[model samples]
Target: MARGMGRWRVLANVAFAAGVLALAGFGVFQVANRRWQVQPTFHVRAQFPNVVGVEPGHRVRFQGIDAGVVAKVVPPGRPGDPVELVLRIDESLRRLVREDATARIVVEGMIGARVVDLKPGEPDAPAVADGALIRSEPAADLADLMRRAGESLREFDATATEARAGLEHLAALAADVRDGKGSLGKLIRDDDVYDNLVALTRRGEKAVEKLDDDLMAVKQTWPISRYFESRAYYERDKVLYRPGSHRESRTLTAEELFEPGRAILTPVGRTRLDEVGRWSKASGRSRSEIVIAAFTEPGPEPELDEALTQEQADAVRKYLIDRHGVDSAGWFRKRKIAAVGFGAEPPRFEDETAQAPSRRVDIILFTPQA
Candidate 1:
């Protein structure tokens, strides 16, 4: 019976050992399978000039979302060759990875770990094929940046030292000037120089007064007097009438007003004319004139273009008069309506293009100075 007990004990020990081994194996399987829960991954390759802090198993992010991981990293064969990385991205986000997508190494936080960032391409771009190579921008090296900052600080220190020396020399020169040791000091301190300057200024004032009297005499004399009067009249006219000239200039493209190569007003043209008529009535300017000017682009036959532009301007004027009752019998009895057309003449403004603005119409309100 004791021999039997010994054999049972041995069997019990083997059973316990087997159970422990099974449990350990299951735990490992669970851990391994957890990594691959987001299944059906697609692989892509990227070549970076520097992957200083990047390593395998580093996270891959697409537009800030965690998408995949770095699968492998291959060091460059030569000094100038780029380091190659194999990335396994989730198949579900395959659409986001396009042919034009760019990959770059980026840091997670301030002086933190590094990861691979993938920028998705335009929405209209085609999806990137599996296992295709994608472009990479190199990661910035922290150590290199720190080194450059140190060098800049050293340079600034040297510049500051030089500036200090220059300021010291300037201060010494200023001290010498204040002590009357230079020509500039003598000019500043001498009473004789001050008296001479005052006398010269008085003589200059007398000479200016005499010149002004001579000009006035010339302006009052015969033929020259007429010239001065004409100049004064012109200046007065400019001052009085400049603000009233082209007080309101509304430019309308030919396409907006009329059919192509036709003088008839379109529906849109009639709508715009209605707005202008309402504005004119609201303005209450009974003495103002309406001037309609039309322009055409240069054509093979200049005469035809001129005639077409004239017809267009006349059509607009007729529309405003007949449809809107802008006539010569009402409050606008004395107001004149004029239509002018320019064929192939460049606009006064150089910024005007040959496209729409050249083929245009301008409606201007001309108010004479009261």
Candidate 2:
């Protein structure tokens, strides 16, 4: 009876060990097959130019959901041939992945594992068949990204070095200027230079004034005056039967007539007034009247505002009379010239803004009846 009991105990132990080994083998088979935990899947192939960080057993995801696993990674046999990846995707989700579905390797997390990501194709498109090749986008590796970043940093360093060199050059130039080492430095440091410039400007002005007076005097001399008189008579006869009174007007912006916030005329203003001079010479009217009307927008100071407008009008009239030889004597005895200032007056246009066109000067010329 003891011998029979020992044999039965040994058999029982052997059966238990066999059962454990079978269970372990089944677990291994399930893990290797992968279909034991989910529905059956279909195999699909994808070719990629590069498959960095991708290998067999990597999880495959469809729209971020766990869908399959990479079964195999086949390296290219030829230099130009692409690396092939075999994927096992769930059959149920197969319809969502069409022939145009793209497969790309992606990083899972910050410096974590990588996975295969499947992007679904158009809904109306036909589904990809089993063993069909899906398109793949090559994954950019961390090493490549680091290399590019290094290149960019090198370029930025070069630029920074150049900027530093430029700043050094500028500092040296500024030091030279401060030490009165250059012509500009001398101009800044020397008061005599400023005084000389002022004296020269005054002399130039006097010379120009004298030249203008001499020219006017020559125009009014015997022979020249007779020629002008004859031209005037001829013009008058030609216009005898036409409308007797002639009027001309010009509108100028405040900026075109005077400096900002000052009645003094800028060089630009003088140049523009030269056009009026030319027009006055061409008019050839002996008995004419010029009305210089200056207007300004409302300002904080009423008296100063009016004074500015008056000064602007006066400046225009004086420029015409003094520089353009619009004399009020001899042939111009009947000529009437006036300057009028309309201070802080609203513009005639209903939609006029506060600035610009509202601040203007109007010059009007009227020729009397023949």
Candidate 3:
């Protein structure tokens, strides 16, 4: 009996030693992993619209490096306000985080814990002060993505069903046409109807040709010829024709319209543009186009000159619309206003042979003769 009691005592001693060693190992592991927060850290506040899986103790990473952990997740005070997170980041990151640094919540891996990913800003940007609020980019939710994918699949199924129905209906209509059951099918089968249609079409073509010849003869007559020439009415082909220009234009110097080498308009520039707006209104051609064209002298930097001309033209267009209520779109959505920039290379017009000004803006009221 005494021997058995001694054996039980030995077993208890072994069990106790094993428990002590396990506890010591656990403590060492925790210390090695820095899980007990032995290092100094600072707080940074960030706001996010949705914090679905984020919570306190979530890891924070700076450019993929583990920096710290989330200390708190504060709920929004108002309904529309974002959820704010307080991050306990290591003090070493204070120099890296900038005023423009952005934060985003991302998953570590498949089925892993959610973490805060911090992206540093430009080197020239000001550093973020400790305890400052940083902006967060919106995080995409897995549940939301899955829901959208499901909705798309349903839409695709619905569209396929509709397409199938339309094709079946079309096939039935084709069968009916082939069986000579409808008016179209009857017309296709009747020889007398086809013959009559051909004869009528030939007569119509002859009548049109004769009318065209008479019109041409009248246009060549003495008085009519003079009238046509004055009007610049000429036919080039059966489908194309040319008409004379009823175009009037006003030219303004760059010195009069803008500050030197800049697109900014001056007081004098505004006055000149105002006059242009008034002139367009008084032109009495509501259907005419209001074209604003800007030109610049050839410079060492052609790109800059082109950009300047474009900006100048756009500035004038904006002023006319804002100050004069110019109708940009006319009846039937026809564009009545246009702005173009010709940088040191002006396109040739029929009656325009004189050299273009070194730098100029032209406001033209153009109407083609009807």
Candidate 4:
């Protein structure tokens, strides 16, 4: 009976072992096939300027999310070249990349883990195929990074040195100002300029006050002001209490009374049409245009030849033949004559007036170099 129990126990143990083995196999298969196993994996390469801190098994990310891992990092198919990073991209995030996706090495935070980050070019890009490698942007190394920081520190030291020099210079300037050395020093230490400025301000204030009083006195003298002064109204151009030269009539428009020579009917003078007829023809412009042109002028340039004389003016033919340059290109020279017309002066008001003297000059052809 004991032997039979022993045989039965052996068979039970064998069956239990087989069942455990089957369950373990099923569990492994479930883990492998689940969680996006069909998703896909893509590979890429990266180059680090230096690889002292980089190693295999480093996580690859996009933005901040985990998307892949570094599989292998080796020299670029040869010796003494940028090392390549072979990435095994996750199936879910692999679709985010395109053929033009860029790979770059990044550190998470200050003194953080180093990883490769892929920027999947544009948003609606096509997914990259398998086994293809994207370009890896060269990354700065630890030494290079430290060197950048050291350069910044050195610059800061230089700036401090400059600032110290500026302060010393300013202090010396202050000492000079106290000693009354230069113009600025004189302004600080002397009292003559301050006295002059104060006196000028007082004069200006007195002049302004006098001008205000004069304006008020003149306002009381006009006919419009006379009505206000008397506080009474009178008939139009009649019922006059007084008549004098101060109240004499004058012309404000062209048809009104004018000087003897300025009347439109006068001969041997600039007729009214001469001022107004420019638009009628193309010779001269209206007085209004002449005034506007006077204001809209480029400032004067220095005289080209101070020593140009009657000899030069008469020798225009000779200079053009000798010194004057020939226009090979024959580009047309557009010349304009500009001058200031200070309105007619005393002579213009008389019936018999002399011609206005023209303050103008003629040009000579001068070249810059021989």
Q: Write the per-residue lDDT of candidate 2 for residues 1-370, one digit (tens) a residue.
A: 9999999999999999999999999888888666323458898899998887777888999998889898889999999899999998988898899999999988888555999999998898899999999888888676565445434433443454455565556556555655778887766766565455446555655655565455446445654444333223211112222245576767788987788988899899998889987786677377776666677878998656766886798798789878986645355274556666667764243122334466888776668786
All candidates in order of TM-score, best leading: 2, 1, 3, 4
Q: Write the per-residue lDDT of candidate 4 for residues 85-125, one digit (tens) a residue.
A: 77878867766788788888877675567888888887776
Query: What TM-score would each prediction reach against the true structure?
Result: 0.42, 0.44, 0.41, 0.40
Worst window of 10 by summed lDDT in candidate 3:
233-242
Model 1 spans > 4 angstroms off: 1-38, 77-80, 190-370
Position 21, candidate 1: lDDT = 97
For 1-370, candidate 1 gives per-residue lDDT tens digits of 9999999999999999999999999887775544443478998999988888788888899988878888899899999998999998989899889988999988787556899999988889999999999877878875565446434433443454455565556556555555667887665666565555446555655655565455456545643344333222212112223354446656788998999998999999889888877766565366776766788889999767867887798788778777876545365264556665556764344232345577988776666676
Model 1 root-mean-square deviation: 32.5
Candidate-wise lDDT, in order: 0.71, 0.71, 0.72, 0.46
Ranking of candidates on lDDT, top first = 3, 2, 1, 4
Highest lDDT model number: 3
**Residue-level error in angstroms, candidate 3, position 133:** 0.9
Clashing residue pairs in candidate 2 are none
Clashing pairs in 4: none
**Candidate with best TM-score:** 2
Give the root-mean-square deviation of each candidate in angstroms.
32.5, 35.9, 27.7, 36.7
Better of 2 and 3 by lDDT: 3
| Predicted structure 1, TM vs. truth | 0.42
TM-score of 4: 0.40
Question: Candidate 3 or 4, higher lDDT?
Answer: 3
Candidate 4, number of clashes: 0
As a TM-score, model 2 comes out at 0.44
**Residue 53, model 3: Cα distance from true site in angstroms:** 1.9
